[model samples]
Target: LSTVHIESDNANNTLIAIGGDNVYLTFTPEEPLLLDSIVVTIAGLATTLTESNGSYTATLTLTGSEPDGILEFTIDFKDRAGNPGIQVTATTDESYVNHDIYPPEIEIISITSNNSDSTWAKVGDSVFVTFTASETLDNISITIAGVSSSYNELSVAKYQGYHVMDDSNDEGDIPFLITYTDLGGAIGPDADTTTNNTNVQFDKTVPEFSLTRMATNNVYGDSLAGIGSVDTLSFTISENQRDLNVELAGSQKTPEQEELNFITTHTFSESD
Candidate 1:
């Protein structure tokens, strides 16, 4: 019978790599006839002949001097009956050269408060971090404090969002580790273990306070006052206070100067 058809495992040209990469070629004939010998020409160079199991298997270790892009090759073989099969020649689809042997570049752009652009925030204030990379990433993640965040593929290298700064965050250089895999899945030395330090000033201290007396239409800020038609007590805080409340002590003086007191509470409005 005449040799009908021939095929290769490396067909469709999807299996690609750099010059130093490995290539495994297995030729399949139309029938299970034993192959006399198989010769493969890659980059215009012929390989040594070898055959097994009615098919041809040749493992080629490409040299660094091989061409970078498309790998052009041809296969010529004959049956054990000494009948020449067919002359097969084909080229691989365009493939990228593995020139990027180094790791991807990672950088911390800024760490800002979620409510504002301030790097310093109160303990309960929400915060976020922004970062970037030099190349497209297959996966990227951040670990802050003792918490690890989920990673996602980045359409662009730069990434930012809620990266785990919350009310539970403590004050200090929040030690964070950034791990990533490049689009080509190349991880350099310490690339997956790279870390960054962000110093976040978390204010947990309460504001200092002072008492002032504001009489009816009184302009002078004073702490003590005498009898007046109307009296108002004012409290001053060192910082912009939120949800402030004041407790007042009501007192009545007897003829013997003995005082009877009662406790009253006052809350401030938002405008105050």
Candidate 2:
């Protein structure tokens, strides 16, 4: 070998480069030195050398499909003086220094009913809910209660649909669940919650009621004189509870009065 100037030897120097190139080694002995071999083993590839020059250099090209990490290899040499020595097996890291992290993710913060068109058919046609992450999401699997659904879309915000999970229309906000996973298999740190773009949410609360007379709904039998009604009823319901039936005690209210009794039954919900 010419000279073992690899700092670890009689010399100390740092030599590093990208791609394929030659690595230098220096040596000097009393007689002409004949070299042996330089071997390289990368994560996914291998190369070798059989002969050498007394004071020459060897080149190795690191390329293709190699895993991202350090690659180790060895260089062995023998001189005419029967001096046998091997360079410490060396390694270099394969790094994607510029690998990009995705943008902030629109975690299924929440989805909700804007109106009649609300959540998913499986999820009690109500509100959709989800969250947003500070990082991007390459893929995410969303399940409700226990049912799994695939949700792999990119957005700064998301409107997740509620999956009813079963055939039960029992009105309650129902159990809400969400999981956001990134491509690297990292989960966000935030305790996920929902937000409302329209600031409107589905209401699921213990409803209240009140009563007042819609009118002095006088009942008069076709008589010579108009008769006065004794029963006066008053009641109140939520505007959301529309199309619900309201009735008075033991009075067959008809037509117009009956229609007012049927009020809508919708709850109000809020999230941010």
Best by TM-score: 1
Local distance difference test, candidate 2: 0.39
lDDT tens digits, residues 1-272, model 1?
22222222322222444334555445567665444456777656665545565556555566646664455667776667877766766423322223233456775445556435364666556545566777665456666544675544334887653444555766655455666666545452233222354445556566775554443433453343333323344445566444444444343212111122112323333322
Each candidate: how many clashes? Answer: 0, 48
Per-residue CA lDDT of model 2 for 112-203, tens digit only, reads: 55356354232344343455666555345565444554443346544344443344433444344555544334344433345453222334
Return the TM-score for candidate 2, rounded to 2 decimals. Answer: 0.36
Give the root-mean-square deviation of each candidate in angstroms.
10.6, 14.6
Worst 10 residues of 1 by lDDT: 253-262
Question: Model 1: clashing residue pairs?
Answer: none
Model 1: how far is 74 from its true place, Å? 4.8
